[model samples]
Target chain A: MPAPAIQVDNLSKLYHIGASEQYHTFREAIIEVASAPLRRLRNFGRASSSDSNIIWALKDATFAVQPGEVVGVIGRNGSGKSTLLKILSRITEPTEGRAHMRGRVGSLLEVGTGFHPELTGRENIYLSGAILGMKRTEINRKFDEIVDFSGVKKFIDTPVKRYSSGMKVRLGFAVAAHLDPEILLIDEVLAVGDAEFQNKCLGKMDDVAKSGRTVLFVSHNMGAITDLCPRALLLTRGSLQADGSTPDVVSEYLSVATPDGYVDLRHWKSERSGDGPMRIEAVEILDSKGARAGQIQAGEPIRFRLSVRGKSGAKCNLSVAIRDMMERIIYNPNTSDDKATVTLPAERAIVEVSLQENRLARGDYSASVWLGDAMNVTNDRVHHCLKFRIEDSSLGQTRSKGLVRTNGQWSVQRRGL
Target chain B: MNPQSNQFTSAMTADESAPAAPSEDIPELIIEAQKGWIPIHFGDLWRYRELLYFLTWRDVKIRYKQTVFGFLWAFIQPFLKMIVFSVIFGGLAQMDSEGFPYPIFVFAGLLPWQFFSESLSRSSNSVVGSSSLVTKVYFPRLVIPLGAVGGCLVDFAISFLVLVGLMAWYGIAPRVGILMVGPLVVLTVIASLGAGTLISALNVAYRDFRYVVPFMVQIWMFLTPVIYSVDIIPEDWQWLLMLNPMAGIVDGYRSAILGKPFDWSNIAISAAVALVLFFVGAVVFRRIERRFADII
Candidate 1:
């Protein structure tokens, strides 16, 4: 058990905000300052004090990163992702708890972050370098590398105010990339620069990671997160909701997501059994030998065992869906696939629904089981469905990720001439 | 001096020899990440002090950047106010300047007072103006206010040079008491830094503090003994007057530059008030600094 590269222990931050409550006259402000202690005592004497309003920006956040690991932090607005980064960078302190870091953290928090508008690009390079805890000699040694990397050789001496936002970002990132901080903490600011710059930064980050530096990256781009980081920490409203392999956590997050943090559990309840109308108890996604497995190779026969009890004598049909991590229905198998509906008797029974998984390729999949009775009608009154994860290795490489692996092939040729 | 240059993590080029993935590259910024008083390398601050000095210089340079009168404006400000007071308060109303000529007398007081006003106003707003830096980058917050105070020295020097010319014209040599002006000027710096820190903290939350600042400076001028001698205030009200720290500061300047002995009781009051202000201001500023990144 080696020491984690980044160790955060019960970290929290509090911010006191003044409401639009009272408008103090200048004299009142001075008088209040004069009597601060007395007013504080008076406020404390009350059951609750409005003046001491606190916003718990980050709460009991604890996690760590192993050396050279690239971790992504994902969340919506005001989820405390940025606040946590600021604390780790030592730009601010936590109200409680301690965060320990083992390396230098280079952050691209914002463009033109430390550049002086009046100073030339060259001057700002030195200034920003100093701000990142680098010395002049270190900057001098890497100056050429930075200039070349940023592609701002021509305007290196020009005052930064004259530079466009794109140029500012290019130079800013060049300096930061060349900063050689052992642990890189990058926010979404990279998305600000041009697409080319963004790609260049991605490549630079790849190189930084290859060179064995730790990186804690935050972005809303799920595609980018899956591609860049091997592991991820998902934040939701100032708490660590999940921390695990990229694919598993992302799938869980997607399933439980809402438009505005208002979670719609329609999909979540579908996969949960044992407390529904039919009294679905346990579900096992099995292989050919009735062996339970979390995954299988694409184009293989997958089995689903769902146990349920029928309280009334109603003919029931079984339906199960195979969806990817995003909950998109990749394949839905019905018990009527044999051209004959299998009717359920009025009693508690164990049932099995097996389907050929040949069409699916190598990727992660989920099983959604539903029990319903609607033999005479096209649609059925379905009960609850259970969720289970299944892996298919037939798509392509075992390492392939995302919605699923598609074995689609393409060929390019010139027109006959 | 990138202190970190020599502190890079141990490299395990061969995979078989590597410890793990993430911790392998963590930088050694903290003396001991897990424990003890993490000593701030003041030497590191010193190495980068040039940027600090330049920022201060930049603030001073930008102040007069688009203005027409340039450095002369620094001189004209206290000079004009000195003439106005010399006419209205000193000549017509016949106020005492310790028997010294009114222009020189008032100019001396105006000099320190102007420094305090300009320094305090700029320092209080320094944090808000540099919010981008505070939120986006990491540096000591104390540096911002210090730079503003440091920037005023340039203007102070320029303005002080004109005071020497005024003295030569009046043929009034600075007395032995002039030596005391050094400590008085220092008290002004400390006092201004104190007030600046406190007001800057408030400025972060209220934002109305920015608008209130100029008005505060105006009212503060009337409260200080810049226009009149402290001797004229009734003894009963003088105790209340001593509460304004700048009161004793300006009077000390008059006593210093005019060859009068120091006012012991008044100096003690000013010292007590200025120290208290600095202590309270530093604590308030430290308390507010935690949320600056979020709120700013």
Candidate 2:
């Protein structure tokens, strides 16, 4: 029967692309201020207004959450996920509409927001605690608890500049975890910590949710979203796409993920280094049917199609290396390794690297390509140029012990028993 | 301070006993941001006073952490400046000190001047220096510059001791009216905070303010009566010089520590001008605070 902890009403935000950019000098300020009236008159005269450069980062976003509800927000890049959190945290003002919260709110848009390297770890805990809006007395009450959680008791009195990066993050997350705000807002800062620390952070978040506080968590990690949140909100192009149970919303989000989970690199605009005679313009991952695959299932055959352009008489052989999320190369297929070379005929050639079966475990992977001649002459090379994911299947464990899965046969003879 | 601690404890107790209050009666904070000026929220500033103190402490702690001289560096700046000015202006140019020893006279004037300039330059950069906190979290943004200004008061305190030493070395004895130093220090801080707040806010939008501020401070020092006595100026134009808040403050310091008659009229004018600057700075700072996280 209680009211919702957070209520948002038609919230929106607009960002000017270029025309409304900042003036960074007094000269620029004077010029702009002097011409302001003329500019307004010109804007008024332009009936068609062809030069409108404003983009709505968020549009009419309305949502409400009951007290103690842990909600997850999921979206692609440029989907206004960050803008929404910024508005809620009051980091930036909303252009229109409003949101209401009924209790003390602590937003961890970033961990270690105000940590000074010269301060000791103990001092930084109090300093960061205050920056996150915790009172001195409250920090006093939980000082030991935070230190104990970070497991940096021995180094507590040492300056944080001396602490390892992992130690600093652990200490930072510990301080944030101990914050007892009635409403906690978190961004993707948890992704910075190692796996064990991330697990501890998630566990602490679970406890916080159970302790009857409201939480709005934003992350690109779908696994974490589904694991921690019972309800999820999906944002696409600044509008709420769906809001429902975690599974339903996640499924909805995944359904809209690039068809077959394959990235099309034909439009890849990142700079590549190579000899001017040859260029690899497009790369893609294709399934058995040659369909663009964003994700490939275990035990399925997959192919990488590299579209290359080269000058006449340019001798180039293609190679690709598949790397896991940690950038550890799982496998590499190289024509030079096989003592073979394919010279460019006239202008363009499509190089195909197909795997009989993708035995990769459930994790994200990226493919990089190189072009060289038979003399081991390097023509062009790109690192982690394309990305894709491997999904779990019946053949492999849900989580693999290593990067790749080998279908090695095992049979037990009766004589052993 | 007592009330803040009491509120902290009560808030803690309230958290421990949460879900006990009638849920229907819980207060809701509506956050509809409109584009316009908002009143100065003194309540929010009071609520975040602890943060202000901590930020000031952080500044002070970080300044001397790895330095060899530590707090002695504060004493060295004004002391060295006094020596340099005495050699050039008092020794070479033979500027009159109006009965006080030239070294002690300049030291007295430099004490307040150094504090004002140091506080002004530091607080002007405070907001931009703490941009990470400004862009990520929401508190009274005014706390940043105010806390930075507070931090410089430590340096002032350190340098004030050097002034006392010089006074003793010159055989100048303190008088009962020296109590006025407290009010003079407060006035200097208010003026610094006011101007610093305005500059910091403008620096958020136009980064040129960064380059402008240092040059402005350098010129500002010459305008203040740090190297010479105010009596050097024509009598009628003396009031015109007091328009610079630091001029009156430096004069008051010399009068107070040297047991000279206090310039009550000029001090009154300086205090009024400082107060006006404080209000104007507050208005400008508050007007731009909401947009700092975005613009910065």
Candidate 3:
């Protein structure tokens, strides 16, 4: 057999938590170096104590992917999925072990990573492409195709700052998608742009996978993962928990957690990205009678009480999405969808949302919250932060198959035979 | 069925016949923890030569994007400095110019001096300024500072025109010794890049190191013979002055243009120091570069 395209053996990375917080100054460094000998003498013969500031972001992760294999990396926040990708892409050095990659490797850790605001779209294409490791000749060959895919041909000569945020994201993804490497590593860059553009990107990725190149995809969207990747790896708290077929690994991930009726968002252990002027401090799942419940009956009405914290007179667009165990988003409810406006008071306030019917089948489900403006800026977001279960309806005990349950009236009339 | 699939199939068939050839064509990349005293990887830098060009282009393009004067500012900066120095040092102090006019002499010296100073300051802050690139992408860290220095070459070329205009005004044509100016300018770049790379690496770890740069450049100008001629110094102490790499470069430019006798000993000493500084700076930069993404 041909050699594996990527081989990772016992890779690990340790990060210092509080040590990074301290300000590093030349004066302090000089003093520390000057006093090193005295300090060593003072602590002579004493065993080195474990420093509390250190945490292993990744530990003993060993995996290999054969050529033409597509693998999905799925994990909750701070679970080492990104850390693993970063190490493989050589953005950060691993603390121990080694990784061998055969053939050309291109990583899209972030889109628009080196895009300059002052540069025109055409110039940024070349600049960002070069930064992403594409040669000039390769970029020249694919220039027209990249621009056509992005749909920003009209503004190709305009500065990037003039483009809308969605336009920028599309252009960024366009350049990255054109990278024809033997091995591709992608992070969650698909979680941008409108739904239609996201579909376009996913289609392009599907084409890339079909071309028989090795790929490692990391995303919080389980539906995308199940659709694109045949095999998957699951990480939990910096450790590889499971590696198997996509369905098995996803099921293993979903089964690892118990449903929660309430979650404290303030101290939630997740990687959140946003410029937060407003935040979702906490969330509570409530039944029809206003009591906390971890499991609700299908077809029953459900309510959510969100504790929001922000400055007074701050306007926010709040959206909550509910997904089933397969992590396919069933439905989303947004305040802006109803043309309703929300203004937060100083400190903290509770905003409640009520749904007429859960309309969900018997299965485990999760709810993710998002706080942002009417524009594309996400002030705060927590993915799959709250989880609950939808039990069978009281009338019947049959197991359900699909994601949603809809009630329909049936009518029949006798006709001439 | 489509062209894309047809290409894929053909490539797969070819690969099946020559499995070992592909590996031989593209070397495998092995990533592990870096050990002590990492040497500079000139091969990796060479492989990423295109990125260096693009980065340098970006810097030069964005520098004068909205400015009304554009490249004229490059000439204006050194010209203004030359006028002020000629008045103060040449007129007020009556310092000797070794036979050439003071404006021409100082202008010649300022041309290389400004290049060195500008390149040094820009490169010293380059890594910190491109924090986004450093943290998000992987390339040779040396390229950032090198690109910054390269961008200044355009400004230096533009400023060289002003020196020619000044020499024309004084009716002092350059002699055959002017050919040596090319090597002298290269020596100046080496010295600037050496100090710049060292400081830029340190600036990533200690942010306050940025403040030290302008102050250091100000003091460094005095130590070098930019505004004054080195002939005024006693012959014995001239060797001590040659320790500053720019002293020899500035002296070399004046002698090259003014047709004075060459100082081989001083130039040789300066070249030696410049090479040593480059070596030390690159060694230190490579050692600390592995932690840049984490800390930055």
Cα TM-score per model: 0.66, 0.84, 0.82
lDDT of 1 by residue, B161-254 (tens): 8888988999878888888888888888889989998899778766878898899999999999887888789876776887888998888888
Residue by residue across A228-324, what tens digits does model 2's lDDT show?
Answer: 8999999987899999999999777765644453444445433244554577777778887888887888767989888788876677788889876
Clashing residue pairs, backbone N/CA/C < 3 A, model 3: none
Candidate 1 per-residue C-alpha lDDT over A68-135 given as tens digits, one digit per residue, 9 for 90 to 100: 89998876546688888888887777777888787656676775567887777888887787777666
Regions of model 1 farther than 4 Å from truth: A12-59, A91-96, A104-106, A136-145, A222-228, A245-417, B1-51, B234-240
- DockQ scores for all the models shown? 0.18, 0.55, 0.55
Query: What's the CA error at residue B213 for candidate 3, in Å?
Result: 0.5
The C-alpha local distance difference test score for the whole of candidate 3 amounts to: 0.86
Ranking by lDDT: 3, 2, 1
**Model 2: residues with Cα > 4 Å off, grouped in runs:** A19-23, A38-52, A260-285, A293-295, A299-301, A304-359, A363-389, A392-417, B1-27
What is candidate 3's lDDT per residue for A105-177, written digit by digit as tens? 8999888879999999999999999999988987887787789789999999999999999999999999999
Per-model lDDT: 0.72, 0.82, 0.86
